[model samples]
Target: MKNAELVVIPSPGVGHLISTVEISKLLLNRDHRLSITVLIMKLPIDSGVDGYINSLSATATPRLRFVDLHLPQGDSASQPQDPSSKSKSPLSFFANFMDRHKAPVRNVVAELTRSDSSSRLAGFIIDMFCTAMIDVANEFGVPTYAFFTSGAAFLGLKLHLQSLSDDHHQDITELKNTETELRIPSFTNPVPVRVLPSVVADKAGGSTMVITHARRLRETKGIMVNTFMELESYAVEYFLNSDKTPPIFPVGPILNLSDGGDDIRTKQSRPIMEWLDHQPPSSVVFLCFGSMGCFEEDQVKEIAQALENSGHRFLWSLRRPPSKEKNKMQLPSDYENPSEVLPEGFLERTTEVGKVIGWAPQVAVLSHPATGGFVSHCGWNSTLESVWCGVPMATWPLYAEQQMNAFEMVTELEIAVEIKMDYFKGFHGDEDKKPEILSADLIEGGIRRLMMGGESEIRKKVKEMREKSRVAMAEGGSSYNTIGRLIEEVMNSIA
Candidate 1:
């Protein structure tokens, strides 16, 4: 048996866990005698991630297991001792929240390393944000590779800033005091202060600490990202050229991790897919905001009206309406009826046209033949899934790296149309137009463009990129070959 063991400290988020699972699966499929253990604050169970992992594990063959590590009670969620929490200021409230989990991260690593079974440990795959693992890996004398859950473009920014903290701490402090664009080394493209990743931009102390710790990644054996070379050629080239950074392995377009079986169908997912089956090819629009996205009641109502007004076949994922009781989140008045989140008489009016669900199997929806275009928040995973499925996007970037991903998709890749823009910045300039936020008129225009409006060229481009992503993931293509190489390297490497 080709023996190797991996310890992954995945941040407790669906996207991060999904990526970690994929890397572990790739390792196991390569025939390595692997003991893959995942450490987390809480395993998603019930309606959360635990259910998803359980579903995946039931079918997994062997050499793979999801391990749950319990940390101090405060490591997860701490119960508020009393109702006086209402009196606390927002900043202090958040600080207390973040403080609780800080210790558990370090504690988990120390506990894991000291375990008797860890003798066979070959390396550790730590999420880039979990910088403490660098110390743990160093103590165990094993190679450490950072797994960036996000894209290469974002990683490029994080790692570049990290390098600045490492070599030119003085310069960074000086630059931060004034409002100036921090020119990332090797990236000729300028990134504005506001456009930087949220973690790096928002936290003064934490940002510096993260970047300083991030420098340790360069000293490690390798760095792996969930993106492909062709998709991020320049960024990948820059990393490889950087003497300070380690070799980057772009083994991504990771839809395989999302894949279960060609025939796999869930009871909850069946009704939505069945409805799509009745729609014409390239005729339906798949609209979904990611898990964290939400809008004011008015905005939600406007969108519901627009989808109703579009008269197009659509499938929309609606979040459970928030409760209006005092001290509770409130849903829009229109969503008060629960079923009314669709539209007044929407299900009845569009019975032949639309399906509204709290959550849909998005990847399956995107992959369906009827799904021709997507109206989305431009999340990285959603964007990748849409491109992989060959469905074009109607970009509606809500926040964070989403805006950057939208620009890359629409401007750099020419795969989709950006229908929204920040109107505060005059759109008359040479800079690309912002995608229209999901307003009623903008939503209608976006849906029409993706369906049958004057966007055939963009749709065609998306189709071509889709095919490229497929070929890359195919039996002997770039991603396929890279995955094979990754398996061989991990299996043959020494502790």
Candidate 2:
């Protein structure tokens, strides 16, 4: 059991934590000699997120252990005002937390390697946000792998764009003065500039985050991404042949389908799942944004109106936007009660056709036989889960690199239908005036196209990709070989 013990540290976010845990599971699933211990960063507040991680860790077999690394916490002023909200910005605040605590993590690694002789240090597999841990692995002469929890196209685009930032005189992560589209090697189509992540859109603080990631990822031994080769072969092949990139591995579609967590079921998931169980096969479109995704009151009403007009079966998870006092970062607004916000008689009129919950069990909902399409914010995890479940999507990205993910899914991959790709960009941070919201007509059109209209080809394409998603993780498949190769490389270094 002590022969090949690997250590992984994940950033504090639940999404990152979940992906890292799944990756650790993949690494030790079939390898009896391998064991893993995950060092989780302790956040400042009692958000229940840490408790969720603890619960999942408890369920992991004896080979996997999760421990909290007593690292320094962020200043109270810097942390989110809402203790329980999952909408913390991954790039800025979390990055600062990791940067501040780097020395503690390094010291921990050094101590483990120095004291533990029976168990060999396989390497440090860290969240991309937690890239500081890589230096510790290097200092102790052990390998480190960056665990990218997004799609490979995005990873390839990141590397390609980073190279451009380095070689070009201008900051490529920032939108150039006249730039309308970005031409990345990983993507065949030129992506519209308006849809890039906040890293590209905001050139000040966000630029530092993007540029820093570009620089740090190159320094790791290799990268392990949460995608399979079949879904991202075009980008994977590009990375493999490029002299610029380190070795790349596609060891995912690392999915966590369970609906349980720390004894909290989000209160609304039960009725939603029960409602789904009674629906006809492949008849419902499930709409959910990630923890961070939400819309203003008008936007929520517009979405409700659109759902009313689409005439298709639907399940929409709504969470109210953090109240102004609680919206510390002034992030976007989320909806809570669909019926309360809907036009009078609207909820009753659509009651038979659609079900709206304040929160839904996303993975379980997506995997259900009744769900045929997903209306997503395109957070990488949500995108992968939809694909892994073989559900097609209607893309409606709200923030961060989600627009980039939406662009990849709709244009680069043809698996999703785009509704309002760049609708709110101009108004996102603008304080003077109200932004033009996406209207019901447009949302209705997108839902119609995605669920029952002319987008049969997209449905078919997603179906095919879903099959490949499964195949890639099977024995002798692309992901299997990639993970095997990655582990072999790590084991060889220690021997």
Clashing pairs in 2: 295-333, 319-335, 320-335, 321-334
Alpha carbon lDDT at 287, candidate 1? 80
Model 2 TM-score is 0.90
Error of 1 at 483 (Å): 3.0
Q: Runs in model 1 with CA error above 4 Å?
A: 43-47, 74-119, 163-195, 203-206, 209-213, 256-265, 321-343, 421-438, 453-455
* Candidate 2 lDDT by residue in tens digits, 386-481: 898989988887666788888888888888898977644321333224557889999999988888754388888988988898888899888999
Indicate the TM-score of model 1: 0.80
Q: How many backbone clashes does candidate 1 have?
A: 10
Which run of 10 residues does model 2 get worst, by summed lDDT? Answer: 424-433
